[model samples]
Target: MELTSTKQRRAAALAIGAASVLLALFVDEPYVLLVAVAVICICIGWEAGLVAVASAGLLSSVILFSLESGAIGGAVRLAVFVVAALALWFVIKIFRTMSFYDRVYQGAGPNIADIPGLGWSAYPDGRLRFVNPAALEYVGVTADEMRRIMDGDDYHWTQFVHPDDVEASMARWHHNLETGEPVIDEQRVRRFDGTYRWFRDTAVASRDEHGRITGWYGQMEDIDDQKKAETALRERERELRLLVDTVPTMIWLMTPAGLPYYFNKRFLDWAGIDAVKEEPRGTRQFASHVELFHPDDRAAVKAVFEKSFARGEPLQHKGRLCRKDGKYRWIDSRFEPLRDEDGTILRWYGVNFDIDDEVRAQESLRLADERLARALRAASLSELSVSIAHELNQPLQAVVANAGAFQRWLTADPPNFNHASRVAQKIIRNADAAAQVVARIRALFSKTEGAPHAIDLNVVIREVCDLLGDTLTSSGVKLDLHLDPRLPATTADQVQMEQVVLNLVRNGIEAMQNVSINVRSLRIVSRHQNDGTVEVEVRDRGRGFSNPERIFEAFYTTKPDGMGMGLAICRSIIEAHYGRLWAENVETGGASITFSIPIRAADSIHTITAATADSRMGAFRD
Candidate 1:
């Protein structure tokens, strides 16, 4: 009976040890697990408790190993389990002798406030419960003095807060106390130096076992530098806003998806669109903003804006906008995306430029140019007809004289064969001369019929030179052409440009007709200017003009028989292409006539079309 009782006691002890080990292994809380381990060690001794821990680890390893397939994985998991179990054993053994609640109380008690920064605690009545040594130093007062200060009915802390921020700070503090919410506020406080500086105070309510409020626990951080920086930034933003509103151009800002958010005062006044009142909630709601644009231009402007916004591209478009006085005026609107450091777009900044006057001026200039071109064409046709008649008359008179001689020789007594043959040759030569004159006239008229295209200035100059090869030779003028190979192609009426060059060359030849053959030199140069325009210069070694500027005027002439319309027509053509034409007298006694046409953008089909559009969009530099 004694042996059976001893065996039963041993069995009971084993069951208790097994129960403790299982509880320690499965319990979620560390303190509870430590308590269970302590109970096991006390009941079965540390040696036996270690054996139980190893057994628990072995069980955990077996469970983990079952989840993995490879031997290496299983071994790693077993080693991990063993190390974790050993570590837990040490922790449990070390902490088993200490009280958990006592350590927690020590950590969170008033003693914890004796840290590097200012720390404090307050009761439910908003009275100071505790203040650390650092807090006393921050407030420039001793513990006794702080206690005395808190004893007063009015909060002494309020006296330290900036007078401007005192009321709001106190109201927030009272609200936090009543609602049991965390207090987080930045307020200016009087420092030890008697100067005000910003401080960020954060506090949360400390609760008791019954979840009742105990006290307020918090830390006060010096944030004077941060507050100063924030203030400066706000001031700068205000200044920038003022600048934007006062600027001549209308300015606005929108979200990345093109929803208007801000409009400068100038924009609001001009557009008459209240950005605040017309705030959009979604993409569909923003479509109503299109009403500010003219009905004819709305669809096109909206399409361009949508495409640019969606693709994160810059926006550029010209459209009519409704003004405050119910008048529609043309505007050049541009949108640029504002992006963050990582290149993520944050918002869109825009500007609307009033271009109504500029557009109207351009249209008027265009109409005036058309009228001038018609007048010049009529004048040119009349002069050309007279010139053609004179040229044909000489060749026709020669033909008539030669034919009469041929008929007279053939009719004379039985044909003087050799003389008749000579007369027939003379007749043939004059007929060929008249045919050549007709061909040149046809070529000139054909050029006037064709439109402008992207053509090389060199090619045009060479063609003109070929047509006037005989004329140059007859006038004893040496033609020099220094064409730049790298010259960009110009968008111009090839025929008109050729005609201008021809006129200049002819004028040069005429001007030097009285000079010696060796000195009568005509130089035609085609080159690319620094400003990205194609410049053609026709220089002559002749009697230079006294007033080069007036030479370009209509019906202004230097030569005795000069119509003076040549230079005028040339200037008008150059201006139509957004180019400039000018003449200057050379110091060495000659004239240099130069015209520069802007090179086509390489992708445009028309010369003046794209250039005119671009010029109307912020081309005026201030």
Candidate 2:
């Protein structure tokens, strides 16, 4: 049983027994109250706490006085004694606490006042110089009884010191006298009856000016609770370690300063350090474990770490790590900077993922895509030349017709007036439209590029839609346009953007190839957002896109007898202009190809990139 608990139970029993006996006596013969008074005196030392021992003694004296004065209410008087004893305990507890600070500064090191809580302890040397009032209360004795024990006693002091600590305490005293040093140990102390309490003893010998040893000073603290907690912690560690060591992936924990505190056994085996169960020396630090990385990949990996140190950002990168057998493998490492409540970096923690297989697969796919792109571009210039000629024929014919009309007007006695001027304007507009198409093709083949400039959205729409206007009419396809008059200009390559619109229109027309004439229609719409973005949407009344997510994959096509590069190039051009391009099946019926470009002024005079400029979101909002 716990020593404190046993002491408290005994104190309770004594209180009840004394109250019962005093009540029976006073109720029968009033003179017997005098005898019951002696029992109170015997129990006076029960409150042997350093702070309340004196107060308990004084209150016990009151009960004795009451009995001498011929008081018949002995039990009620003792109830008053308990209340008065508590009042005195508080007063002395506060006084003792204050005196403790005073004594600490006066070179009388800590004494009983050093212990503020009600815990058990006894004088180890067959004497009671300072017993806390709480210790007295624990043993069915009162403060007056405790003072008598302090002044002089045999049975009381004998029952206090446990048998186990008596010899150790004696040996420590002699050792302190001989060596002039303190002795510290943990042992059991005897309670009032037969119980033992756990305690941690601290004793030191005083020194003189000449370095000579004087009398020893000491304290014994209760440690049963601390001992129990330590035992529980050890058991928990075993369970946690068993789980960590058996995980499929090797795990490690490192300090923010790059020190590794733990590495499971699997991690040790993976690193090829079989001689030691674990590399205790290397496990303690990040730098110590650097030798495990492939030397060639170290510089780049080190630079990636600057984000955490210099910018206070997270550190994340995939780098090669060397195994014990000198074979280097890749590991995806991620470290996040930790900060204190005040926003100061406290440390960084990290994790690693083995992504070697994923990395190899991506590299393989990249090579295959590059080869396919090369094969597609290897198309014959002779064949392209024929197609270009066929496309250029109609514009040439219009030019010829406009010239003929002008000549006829010149030959007329009276000119055809506005007819010649309008014909000449048409000639110029058609020539510009043909030139813009050629320019788009040339720009697409350029090696270097520039940021998009402000372009009139309506002008692009009208010219391309008008060029395809005749084709749609002849193909029995209906067209609808909803253009915003005050729509803001877009920052995009004009001819490239036009080609995108034209391509979508062509695809829409193709989807309606076998549809009823009434259903074979395309609608183009434009709207200006409050945020400086203009959206262009091409809606068709026919078939929808298949697998929208995969549709944007390079070379993934929806059309047969088509290069499939057209829509891909359109997507690239739209994205390059800091615009978004996507196709989704509209809930109504068909697919909608919607794209949007920022319509704001250029962010800066210098060339700008996504990384170097205000983001698209900011740019559009601004």
Task: Compare the candidates by lDDT and give the number of the best one.
Answer: 1
lDDT of 2 by residue, 17-46 (tens): 467456644554332333233333333432
lDDT (Cα, tens digit) per residue for candidate 1, span 184-252: 988888878899888888999988899888888888888889888999999999999999989999997
lDDT of each: 0.71, 0.61
Candidate 1 weakest lDDT stretch, 10 residues: 613-622
What's the lDDT for candidate 1? 0.71
Reference-based TM-score, model 1: 0.54
Quick one: RMSD of model 1?
Answer: 23.6
C-alpha lDDT of residue 285 in model 1 = 44
The reply for model 2, stretches above 4 Å from the true place, is 1-248, 251-263, 272-287, 296-319, 332-436, 448-455, 464-469, 477-482, 488-494, 504-513, 518-524, 537-569, 582-594, 600-622
The TM-score of predicted model 2 comes to 0.46
Candidate 2: how large is its RMSD?
18.7
